[model samples]
Target: MDLPIETTRLRLTELTLTDLADYENLIMIPEISVGAGFNLVSNPKMLGAVARRQVTAPNSFGIRVKGRLVGAILLHEQVGFDYQPDHANLELSYFLHPDWWHQGIMSEALIKLIEELTASKTIKTLNAEVFSSNQASKGVLKKAGFQKKTTLIDPLVSKEKVIYQRALR
Candidate 1:
């Protein structure tokens, strides 16, 4: 709903070309890349292209700490769910640099984003699917008021995933 939402220790802003280098570095980390369903990119040009697309992608935000890019959050159309045609729903996906893990920074950023999106009244629901093995992400979602809706094997990644959902209204 708004660009550059701020929390106590982080800034959530629209991704830009200027963030390309940091984005590339963060996205290349194996733990983050693989966990987020991204194929490892070795070619610099292809990496740059992906970074550029992320910059231009709608509802994508760069998670910055102290003016440095450390993570990202993306909201897109939610699939595999049935709902009234008029209801607006989106799926959430996020990844953070390993150095920032377990710091509660992600929970903080996610809470703020949820607040802004709910306040805008444009979103009726939000959903996130986390690998069942990713307890940290599950904790983050639970802390942000999401509830487990279902569990299934994610075809794209072939991993068991737990779907969490939060209703705004």
Candidate 2:
């Protein structure tokens, strides 16, 4: 919920209504959608709707590189979905522009985010689901200290979804 979650070469901040254009461009890329699950952008109206919803969602952050919106991250509380009494299970999701892929920027950003969130003690667990074919995302989560828990066959995508979890304590 804070603005400008600063990393060495990037800034993570909340998405705003004006960021729709950048968000649209980022998610519409074929490669980006493949990993980020951007089916919500199949049509213009749906794209607009998803973009608008992103800006209003709680704990969604736009990742910026040198003042340009190049990616986005989200932390969602999974209420009643595998609930643990003492720990809040928050889902972590992120996407970076294809052009910025393999540059280590995303890994750095994620490490910084985990540090901040853990220090705050607001979230007790961080969870992520990555398509089995998404090697980069799998690597990012591992580098951020998340352990692979299990794999589920996602019917919609017809691919294995690797579930990763990191306890924030």
Candidate 3:
């Protein structure tokens, strides 16, 4: 998918190994991916392999700000937390460099992603699970139109993750 989606302040596109340097910081940070239930750091080559696989997954996108890669926003079709699918539903996941925080870059990227996904008929619901303590993530998701669905401690992800959901239709 040649996304190339753009907003006034953000962009969403497919990522390649060339982007390793672009996303190295956020993807490697334990803090960022810790709450999201997936960590990509430990090995650069492994992350590259994952990105390579994702390029064909049809479910994830690289988040860019002003043409520079800053983070990743993905709409996963399946997750262990819940074997749930609303036919066109997706789960929200993202991680960004601390440098991009507070600039509303994520907010913009998310809005554009939702609009694009909806336009493409890719999804109608977007669910997310944020660590209860991760207020920053909660705020970003809230800005993206996701409302609190539930706050149960995720058994699979441990007690830190809290579930949230958004319906696009």
Candidate 4:
């Protein structure tokens, strides 16, 4: 619960309840939500609920730029995922505000996170399932040393999700 990963231009820390408004504003952008999954929140009440859920999620982190929450990154243990037999799996996912896209903020944050998490010895393999249409996410992952393993159709999202993985140990 005390995870905090930092880079030159961004900080990844636990999402707090106080970040609801900023988180909502970032996530409600339709373009941002599409690649990250889900639709924009339609009302303030729904936004509040969504924010609460994120804040309470076990390993979710808010990405800060100049002291403001502009995005999020999460690493979650996969329970029933069809993982490789030799390693436990952790799924990595991230999204940045459209305004910050193309600036390499996410790439920096994620590269640093992988270093920190790998050094901690708490993760065996870091995996990602990105929407096939999301070339930016794919590029970020590949740049951070993840290798494409397969492509599977995700029934929940009704799209092809490309599976990528990197060994931590």
lDDT by residue (51-85, candidate 4, tens digit) is 67877787778889999888888777777545543
TM-score of each: 0.88, 0.91, 0.79, 0.85
User: Distance (Å) between predicted and true CA of 12, model 2?
Assistant: 0.9
Cα error, residue 154 of model 4, in Å, equals 1.9
User: Which candidate do you rate higher for TM-score, 1 or 2?
Assistant: 2
Overlapping backbone residue pairs in candidate 3 total 0
Task: List pairs with backbone clashes in candidate 2.
Answer: none
TM-score of 1: 0.88
Q: Is candidate 1 or candidate 2 better by lDDT?
A: 1
Worst 10 residues of 4 by lDDT: 80-89
- The per-model lDDT (C-alpha) reads 0.88, 0.85, 0.72, 0.81
lDDT of candidate 1? 0.88
Question: Cα lDDT of model 4 overall?
Answer: 0.81
RMSD value for candidate 1: 2.8
Please provide, for model 2 over 1-169, each residue's C-alpha lDDT reduced to its tens digit, 9 standing for 90 to 100.
3567897799988888888888988888888777777773568787778878987787888889999999988887776645543336788889999889999989988998888888888788999999988888899999999999999998877889999999998
Please tell me which predicted candidate would have the highest lDDT against the true structure: 1
Residue 112, model 1, lDDT = 95
The list of candidate 3 runs beyond 4 A from truth reads 38-48, 79-87
Clashes found in each candidate (C-alpha, N, C closer than 3 A): 0, 0, 0, 0
Error of 2 at 81 (Å): 5.3
lDDT tens digits, residues 1-169, model 1?
7688998899999987788778888877899878875665667788778778877788889999999899999887755445434337888899999999999999999999999998999888998999999999999999999999999998876789999999987
